[model samples]
Target: MPARYCQDSPDAIASCVLEDMVLLYHRPSGQTHMAIAPVPEILATLDDGAALTAGELLGQLAQLYDLGEPEEALPLVEAHLAELAALGLVRIA
Candidate 1:
């Protein structure tokens, strides 16, 4: 399970209004880079530079996608995370 970068729109994903988004980038040589989205200037209360973890990311997904609980979202999140990591989108943190 690896992340496949949408070559057509590598940087088109939007970030949160109050939080930063994490992205895993895969290079042709089979390496992954974790690219954290920077908070937009217009967005307030998003100054912290801390990177989001899997659990935290699940929470974000729960909120953004209106899921009921982090537990429920955890599996999906983990799957995607693992996929991304496998494809050199990110490394397990």
Candidate 2:
């Protein structure tokens, strides 16, 4: 099976939109992250607490945004998920 990712916890982070940026405050780490575009959208998609593969996430996002080609977006989504995982914002499940 492909790797699956889930957000750390709904309570672990607090977020708000400022202009075009999404500001995320991670309570556990007391750190804030500024995100743009699909980062914020990715976090929001994970907010439902579903563990999803990059392909699954791309499908969900495709419903809400015109991401062009899924083939192109898959790697980008995977990269974003990996980055989020490294930041402790998300975890592999």
Candidate 3:
């Protein structure tokens, strides 16, 4: 099975959209993160806290944005998720 990822606690994070960027405030770590494009979309899709594989995330994201090809976006999504995990915005499940 593919690895799954989930967002951190909803209460632990606050976010706002500024133009094309999303600013995320993580209460636990007292860190502010600036995200753009797919990063914001990825976090929004995981707002429900449901663990999802890269492919699953891509599917959801495709519905919200114009992602041309799932095959091409899978790797990019995975990379974003990994980065989010490192930033404490998400975790591997």
Best by TM-score: 2
TM-score, every prediction: 0.44, 0.96, 0.94
Q: Rank the candidates by lDDT, best first.
A: 2, 3, 1
lDDT of 1 by residue, 1-93 (tens): 422221222332333332354433333543434434211221111113324555665555455456566677666566665654455433443
Candidate 2 lowest-lDDT run of ten: 7-16
lDDT, each prediction:
0.40, 0.93, 0.89
In terms of lDDT, which candidate is strongest? Answer: 2
lDDT of candidate 2 at residue 18, scale 0 to 100: 98
Evaluated against the true structure, the overall lDDT of model 3 is 0.89
Clashes of each: 4, 0, 0
lDDT of 2 by residue, 1-93 (tens): 899999867899899999999999989889999999999899889999999999999999999999999999899999999999999999999
Rank by TM-score, highest first: 2, 3, 1
lDDT of 3 by residue, 30-86 (tens): 999999988878988888989999999999888878998778888899999999999
RMSD of 1: 10.5
TM-score-better candidate, 2 vs 3: 2
